[model samples]
Target: MDSLCPLTDAVIGDFAREDAAQLYTLVGRGARSHLKVLRNGLEISEMAVSDLPGNPNAVWTVKKNIEDQYDSYIIVSFVNATLALTIGDTVEEASDSGFLPTTPTLGCSMIGDDSLVQIYSEGIRHIRADKRINEWKAPPRRQIVRCAVNRRQVAVALSGGELVYFELDLNGTLNEFTERKLFNADIACMTFSEISEGELNSRFLALGTVDNAVRIISLDPNDMLMPLSTQNLPCPPESILLIDTPNDDGKGVAAVHLNIGLQNGCLFRNTVDNVTGAIMDTRTRYLGTRPVKLFKVQVQGRSAILCTSSRSWLLYHFQRRFHLTPLSYANLEYAASFCSNQCAEGVVAISASTLRIIAAEKLGVAFNVQSFEHRLTPRRIAVHPTKPCLVAIETDHAAYTEVTKTIKRNQMANDVEAMATDETEAELAREIAMNLREKKLDERVFGAPRAARGKWASAISLISATTGEKLTYFELPQDENAKCLALVQFSKHPDAVMVLVGCGVNEPLNPNTVTPEEAANRPVRGCVYTFHLSPTGDRFDFLHRTETPLPVGAIHDFRGMALVGFGRFLRMYDIGQKKLLAKCENKKKRYRERERKRKASES
Candidate 1:
C-alpha cells in the first residue's frame, strides 16, 4: 500500500501547471478540448485549441514559463508540429511546421524566456521571441531523439546514438557546438545539469538509452563529452530525475542524487560523485505493474516520488541518499494517462471524467489506516530523531470482527457454484447467490482481525509525517494493553532508545463467568513495561516491567523521577530512591487569580 495508489485518470493527452494548485489538461481527440483543475475538482470549460490561430488538435508537450512567475505563459507543442504560447484565455502562435516549405517533422522541443528550440528530422531550429529563425543541420539522416535545455546550455540526444551540446554565448552567438558519440544504442531521454561547488566544476549530461542502460556523461567547457559511467537496467529506462542538495536561496547544488524509472516498473536510486559523475551507491525497487512517470514531488513538506502509471499513483519515500522506499499510494478510478508538474505538492492528472490533483499528503499512504486494516488505531506517536516522521504505537480495538479471509474464500467458492450449477436449478442457484451477497455484506460491515490469522497484538508503526507513509510495523504480544507510551534516548546509547509503555486494562479478563460484584471489585493493577528499540528503529526487545499501586493515566520522566498521573491524584517516584515520594490530589480550580496574576498598580 505504501508503494502503490489507485488513481482516476481523465485520459488527457498532456497537461501543464504553474502554481501548485492550478492545472490545465488537454482533452478530447478530434476536437481540442481542455480541462482546468483548481485543487478541488476539474472544470471542463468550452475552450478548444481551435480558438487559437493554428487550430491544433493533439498537445505533445506543455511547460510553464519560468521567467514570468506572476502571470506566467504556458508553452505548448502540438502533434501538428506547431509551437504556441498561451496565457489566460489568449493564445499566440510561436511557430508552425505547416508554414515551412518542406513541412519538416518535429521530434523534440525546449522552451525559454524569449526563445524556443525545436528538433526535427533535418536538424535543430531556434525561434527567437522577435520571430528570428536560426537553423543548424544535424548528422546525416539522423533525427534528434530527445533534447533538454537549462539556461544557455542545451543537450540533444540523436537517434543515431550521438549527443550534441550547444551553448549560447553572452554576445548572443552560438559557439562551436560539440558532438560526441557515446551510446551504442539510441538515447530515449536525457537531462542537463550544471556544475556545483561539490562537483569540482564538472557539469553532466545524464542519458537513458533504449538498450536499458543509463550513461552519465561528464562535460567540461573545454573538453569533449565523455562517458563517466554506464549502468545497465533490467528494462529500458523511461524517465530520469537528478536531485541535488540545495544551498541557501535554493539554487546552489552540492551533490548528484539521481532516480531512474524503467519500462518494467522498476525504480532505481543512485548517488553520483559530482566531480567524476561516477555512481557511488545504487538501490532499486519495484514501483508498479505498468510503466511509470517517475518524478520528485513535495508532499506535505516531505520529498517523495510520484510514480504515475497506467493503473494508479505510487508515491515512494525519497531520501537525499538516493534511495526509493515504499511510502504510500492510492487506487484510482481510472489510470492516470497524463500528468504534469510532478515535482510539486499538486500534480494534475486526468482520466475519463476524473480530473485529480494528486497531492502527496492527501493521497494514499501506508500510514493512513484506510490504506490497510481498520482494527488497529494509533494511540501514541513519537517523532524520529533525524527523519521527518513519527513512531506510532497503535493498539487494536477488539470490538470489530474482520471477515477478510473467510469472505474472500467464500466468494471464490460461490463463483465455482454459480458456474457449475444451472439457472434451471432455481433453488441451488438462488441459494448460491444469496450466500454470495451475504458474504459480501459481512465483509463490508465487519472487517477481519489479526487474531483470526493466529496473531494477536498491538504494534509500533514508523510513519513519515509529511507523506503519511507507514514505513514499518512491529507487532507486539497482546498480553498487555499499552495505554500511554514514551521514548527516551540517552547520549551514551545513541543507537537505541528506551521505550516506556503504560499498561491499562481495556477488557475484562473473565467476563463470561464472573458475577457483577466480582467484576466491580476487581483490582486495577497497573504496570510500566520497558523495551529497547532496535538500532534501525524497526523492532523492539522487551526488558522488564514494574508494577504500580494505581492505574496510570499518563507518565512523564522529570529529573530522573517518573511522574505518574492517575484519575484522582498525581504521584512522583524517584528512580534512585526506588519508591514513591509524594502524591497530590487534583485541584478543582486550576488557578488562583490574585495569587498567580498581579495587577500592574499593585506591582
Candidate 2:
C-alpha cells in the first residue's frame, strides 16, 4: 500500500490479457498524476503523467489490434486535458504520450470507433482517434453531476435535478434526444443497464436520488425517459442495479429486478413488470453496519451482486432460491468496488491503497472470526449494562506472587521499625522473615520455582461489542487478582452505573508443616474495587475500594445493594454508605425457609 500514490479511480478492460481482463488504476493528483496496471493482484507496469496539465480524474482503456496482436490504448482525463498512452505488455511498449486539450473533465467513456466521450461541468465533448474534437453544450446554467454511457445511448444527470438523455451517431456526435426534470430531488447515482439481444441500445435507466427513492425509467425509443416505477426506501440509496429476469415460459425477458443499496447498510430488492413497470415482491435484508455499495460480478461462472459495506457479501441464486452469503475467504476493509476479472473463480477488490485478488473455491464457509491479542490470559468477563461493551479480566503467570510479596514486604517493614525500640519486636521480625523464606522454598519444591514466577501485572480491558476493537484498559494493583466482575447501580445513585470487580489474594501453602486445622484457620484476603464510566463511554474512572477478610469469589447487584460472596459466606453491603447490611451462611435451603416463614408472618 502506497500512501504517496493513493488510488482514486479504477477500471477493468480486456486490454492485453486474452484469458482475463486487466485493471487500470488512476492514482495521485495534479503534478503527481500516475497510472498503474495490475493483473491478478500483481502490478505489471506503472507510468507517470508529468506532461499533463491538470490532475487526473478518471481513466478508460480500449483494446485495439496492432500487427495482428491485441494492444490497449489507455486514456486519462484531467481537469483541463487528457493523456493517451498505448502499451502492449509493459511500460517499455508504451508509445509517446499524446495530449488532447479539453474543458475540465469530470468523466470519460469509450463510445466505439476509437472515439471517446468526455463529460464536463457544462456539456460533453467527443474526441476521436484522429484528434478531432466535437462539442455539445447543454442548456445554460445546467451543471452535470454524473453521466453513464452505453453503446448508443447516454444518460447525464445535472446538479439542478434534471436528467438529459442523448443518442450517439455513427459520426461520433452526441444529439440531445430527450430530457426530464425532477422537481425537488437531485440524482445521487445513475446507471444504464446492459444491452439485451436484438436490442441496439440499453432499454432501461436506474436512478437513485437523494430523496431516498429509486426510479426506473424506460429508455425505449417510443417512451424515452418515461418514469416506469418508483419505490421509496428507508434511507437514501447509494447504488442501484437492474437485472433482467427470464420469463416463466422460457421465451425472452419477463421482468427487470431492481437491487438497491441503501445508506443504512441494507439491500432492497423488488421485481418490476417488463411491460407495465409496476413494482412487486419487495424485500430487504441487512448486510452490514456501513453504507452498502452494489457491484455486478461473475462468481463460479454465474452472475452475482457484490455488496460492499463493513464486510463484503455475495447475493446469488442457488437451488431456485436467492441466497445472500458473506465471502469468507476475502477479508476486505474500506473496499470501493469489486470485479471478477484477472482471477479464476474469484474477485478483484480495490481499496484505499492496494488491489486485492482473492480466489474463493468455496464462496461462503461461515468464517467471520475476530481476534484480539492479549499478553495475559483472560479469567473473567462481564457485559456492560446499558452499552454494547464488555469488561474482561486478564492475569499473568504469577497471579499470586504480587499478593505474597506485598504481605512479606509490609510485615518486614513494620517489624524492623518496632525492633529498634524493643527486643521482643526484633525476635518477632526474625521469625516472620524466616517463615517467609520457608514458604518461598515450599512453593518452589511443590510447584514452580521462584525464577519461573513472572512479574505481577493484572489488567482489565473495555471492548466494543460490534467491531471487537479495544476501547480502553486499566491495570489492577499488585496485591490483587481479579476474580469476578459486575455492573451495579447503588440505591443512592440509581441513575449511575458503576463497574464492580471482586479480587482474591494468592499465597503459598506448605502441607508438610501445617495441619488441616491450621490450614482451615488461615485467613482469606481479598478486595472489592469499583469504577465509574467516563462521559465519553470509552474509559473507566476509579471510584473506591472495599477490603474484605475473605477472598471474594462473586459479586452481584440485588435491589441496589451489592451481594458479595466471601468463601463460605454471603454478605450484602450498602455501597453508598460503605456499611454491611446483612450476612448469611452459604446454605440455600436454610435461607429460603427463613424467607418463606417471614413472608407468611407478614401476610
Candidate 3:
C-alpha cells in the first residue's frame, strides 16, 4: 500500500514555480511586487519589480523555459495593449525588453512556446514572437468570457454559453472560425491539453460551467470543439485542471486527470478517457471551506497531487484505484499559493510571508486523516414510445433509506448512548424502520389488494419535442411511492399507454404476524398501474392495477411479453394468458463478487 509522506516546508510569496535548480516567485506586499529567488529552500536574492505597459490587473501566462532551450517570458493582455516581459538569467532577474503594443480588455490569455493567443472582451487576437500576427472580431454584443489555445487552434467561450473554435494558420494567424452551443450554459473556466506529445497528438478542452457541469470537447481536426461528454457536479465549479498522466505502460495521456475545484472548498478528481473524454471514475477530497488549486506532480517515478486551499495546504500521494493518501498538511496564516515543478519532485509553496521548497520525499503522515468520499451514482433514464423524447428520473433520495437501514442494523450492536441523539433523529429512525417492516410484510404476502393510503405525490410533465415547450402536467396518487415509468409502444395499436410502477405498504398483511395463512393470502406491495393518454394529450385516465412480487424499478416488452425488473430479479409474464412465462434471478451476489474480482485485478 502507498502512504502519504511529508517532505519539506518553507515561507515566501505567492505565484511560485520550481525550475531545474531554483524556485521563482512574484513576491511582495501591498502595491509593490518583487522577484524572489530561492535555492534549496533558502531565499537567495530579491529583485525589485518593474511595471510594464498596460493595466496590471490583467490575465497573463508565464511560458517558462521548461526544456532549458528557450527563455521564459510573461505575456499579458490581448491585441494592442499586451506586452511580454523577459525573465533574466536567474529567478531574481526581470527585464522589460520584450514589450509589445498589445490590446487590452481581455479575460483570458494563452502563451505558447513562441506564440500567444488571447480572448478580449469582444474579440480574439494572435501574436507571434512579440509581433501582432492576426485578430478576429466576434459578433456584435457577444462578449467573450474565457478561452483556451494550442499551437494550431483556439477555443473561445462566449458569455451566451456558446463555444467558438478557430483554426490557426502556419504563421500563427486565424484561418477560420466555427461556433457551436451545448446546453447553452454559462462557462466558468476552461483549460486545454494535448493528449500526447507530437504532431499527430489529439487535443482536448475541458470546460467548467456555471451549471455545475464539466464537458470535454475534442479538438481533433474532424471534430473541433465537439463535446464528447459531460459530468454533472454536486456544486458549482470555479476552475478546471487537466493533467496528462501515464498509463500502466508508461505512456502519457493514456489517462487524463481532471481536477475540478468547487466553490465549497471541495475538489473532484476524475480520470477521464483520453479519446472520448468520458469520466472513468471519480473521487472527492475536501480541503477547506474555500477554493482549491490542483497541481500534478511526479515523485520517485510516480504521479501525485499538490493541492492548495485557504489557510492550509496538503500534499497527497496518488495511489492505485483512485486512492489519495495524504502525505502531509500545513496550516498557514495567509492563503497559500503553489508553483509546481514539471521535471522534479518538489514544489514552491507561498503564503503570508513565507516561501518554501516542499519536496515530495520530505512530506510526513498525519494520523486519523479522513478522505471526503461520495458515491458516483447513475441516474435512471427512460425513453418515450413513438415520441422522440427522454425522461431522466432524479433518484437521489432512494439511497437515504438504505443508509438508514445500515444505521438501524448496527444500532443494536453498539452502545445505546453512542447511538442516542436528538428526538427528531430518533423519531425519524423509528419511522424508517416501521416503513421498511411494513414493506417487507406486503411483499411476503404477495396476493392482497392495495388499501387507501396516506397522501404522497409526484409529477409527470409532457414536453413538446419541436418547440421545447411543456405541454401538460399530471400529479401522481398520494398512496404509493413512484419507482419507474415506461411507455408501451405497440405498432399494431393506434395509441400508446403509460405504465407506472409504485410500491408502498399502505396496509399490513396480518399485522399480528401469528396468522401465517392470512399473511400468505395478502397481495404484494409492488403495483403496476396503467394510464390511458387522451387524444388531445393533456390528460390521462387511470385504467387498472396489478400486484407484483417485488418493487419493479423498470419494465420492458419483448416478443409480446411483459419483462419486469422486480427488485433483484426479472420476470416475464403473458398478459393474455395471465400466467408467468419465465423468471430469472439477477444473482446480485455473484455479480458483486465478479465486480470485486475485477477491481482487485485492476489494483
Candidate 4:
C-alpha cells in the first residue's frame, strides 16, 4: 500500500527514466515530412510509424487527444512534466502550457477540476518556476504537489467518510467559480457513467467507499441537493471496473477484485441494468493466488477480462467452466499503469506513453523467432487497443541484448519460420534449442488462449510481440558486467539492425578519488558498442563504436519520431526529412515573426 505505482499514465515510463536518454531519429520508408518523435514511450525496439500502401492516414502512435476549445495536448515528455497546447487548434500563436504553475513538478492534482482536485503536497517542484507562480503566496507553502487535470469530475474523501463533487470551470480564473457538493463518505474513487443528453439529473456516478460499499449518486448540477440511488454490495469491493453490454436491456457488469493474500486473488462480477437498476447475474471466480498492489483491470467482453500488474498480466475468459488463463510472460520488474484505451473488442492495452490508440487489425508471423539464454525479464508493456500486437519491455541500462534460455511456455500454436542461416544466427538457434530442449515454452508462460495473440515480457530483459500468429522475441545483448542490455537497435543497412550495448564507467580510477580539477583533466569515459547485425546473423560488421555527446537516459523509436527525454527536456525528432518543407517553413516563420512583434508591442 505504501508503494504506489507512481504511474498516472501506463504508457510512459517514469519521468526520471525517460528523461535520462538521448534518442536517434530516422526516416521511415514512406510517410515523409511528418512531425513525430523517433521513439515513443520507453521501449527497446523502435516504432514502425510509417503507413502502409493503402492507409495514408495511419500512424504508429497518437501523441495527444483534443480536449476541446480551451485546450489540446501538443507536447508531453515525462521528463519535462510540461504539456504544450493550443487555445484551440485553429487559434494561431495562442498556445498554453499545462504547467499550471510553470515549474518542474513530481506530482499534480485537479485544481481546475472542481471535483476531486483540491491540493496535493509531498511532491517535487523546482525553485525557478515555483517562485514566480507562488510569489503571491500568503501562507507560503514552500513545497507543493501536483494533481491530474482531465478526469472531468472530482471526488474528495474527508476523514470521516464523506465524498463531495463540484462543477469544473476552465473558462475563467480559478477564484470566480461555483462549487457543488456531491456525497457523504470516504470515497475511494468515483467514475461517471451513463450520461443522458438534455437530462442533466439523469447522469449516474458510481462511488466506491472505504466501507466496501457501492453508492449510485445521481445529480442535476442545476439543482444541487440531489436524489440518487445508493446501492450496497454484499462484499467489500477492493477494485471496481465498469463495463457496458450492448444487450439493450440497459445492463452492465462490474468486475470486483477482492483483496486476498498474495496467492489467492478472487474476481467477481455482478450484472445490473441501468434503465431500471436491477441485479441480473452475480458470479464469483477465484482467478489466481498473487497479491497485486498496482493492477489495472480492463473489460473486453462479459467473459474476457485483462488484469495487468507488475509481476504478470492475465486474460481471464470464462467459457464453460471458470478458467483463469495465464498469458505467457517472463521477468518484469516495474509496471506503471495500463488501460485498454477504451477499445475492448479485438485487442486493447495502453500504448507508448499511455496515449491510447487502435492498431491495425492484421497480424503476421515473424520470419525468425527464438528464445535467448540470458533469461530476459520485462519491465513495462502496452497493448494496442484495436490491434493484436503487444509491446513488453524491460528497463534499459545502456544498449545491449541478453540471450535468455529460460523458456516459459504456455499454450502452443502452429508456428513456422525460416531459421537463421549464418554462423552467428545458427549459433543463436542452437542456444535456444538446447535451452528449450527439456521444457516447452507453453508450460512456463501459461494462462494463454489456444488461439491467443498478444504480447509477453519477462525479467526486464526480453519483449515478445505477437501479431496474430506471428511472434518476434527481442533479447538483450551480452555485456561485460552481464547486467546491462542493448537499448537501441538501428539498421543503417536495410538488412541489419544496429546494436547498442549498455555500459557504465567505473569511478575512483586511482586508489583515492580525484579532485574536480584533476578529474576534469582526465574524466572517465562511458562505454557503448555499436555494430551491424545482418539478417543472416553475420558477424558484428562494425563493432565497438561509442556515441558522442553521450546519450539520453531514455530512448524510444516510434515510426519516424524519436523521443529522447534529455536533461529534463523532451526532444522531438522529426525523421520525415532532413528539413521542413520550404513553402511551409517560410509561411510559418513569417507568421511567428509577426506574432512575436505583436506580442512585444502589447506587452
Provide the overall lDDT of each model, using Cα atoms, as 2-decimal numbers: 0.51, 0.62, 0.50, 0.32
- Give me the displacement of residue 502 in model 3, in angstroms: 72
Model 3 per-residue lDDT tens digits across residues 1-603: 322211111123221122112222223211121222333321111222233332343333344423443335444443356555453443332344233344554433334456655566767766566665566788888887777665556677777788776765655456655457554678888877643765633477889988888998887778767789899998878767787666666655456788887888888888888657788689887866667655444454555555555534343434433334333334222111123232134443333334333454333332322121111111233435544333322222222233343454455334433454988767666666556444443321342222232222333444332232344444444334455666554333435545444443322323454356644654336666555555544445565666776656677765554567765667654432232334444535467888999999999
Q: Is candidate 1 or candidate 4 better by TM-score?
A: 1
**Models, CA RMSD each:** 20.8, 15.1, 23.6, 28.4
Give the Cα-based TM-score of candidate 3 against the true structure.
0.43
Candidate 2 structure quality by residue, lDDT tens digits, 302-324: 55677777666777654555667
TM-score of 1: 0.44
Error of 4 at 22 (Å): 38
> Which regions of candidate 3 are displaced past 4 Å?
1-61, 64-71, 75-84, 90-113, 198-201, 248-253, 295-306, 311-603
Best by TM-score: 2
TM-score of 2: 0.55
Q: Per-residue error at 572 for model 2, in Å?
A: 3.3
Candidate order by lDDT, decreasing, is 2, 1, 3, 4
Weakest 10 consecutive residues, lDDT, candidate 1? 28-37
**Model 1: how far is 160 from its true place, Å?**
2.2
* TM-score of each model, paired residue for residue: 0.44, 0.55, 0.43, 0.32
Q: After superposition, how far is residue 565 of candidate 3 from its true place, in Å?
A: 72
User: Best by lDDT, which number?
Assistant: 2
lDDT of 1 by residue, 512-572 (tens): 7656775466544566666666666445566666776555678776555456675555666
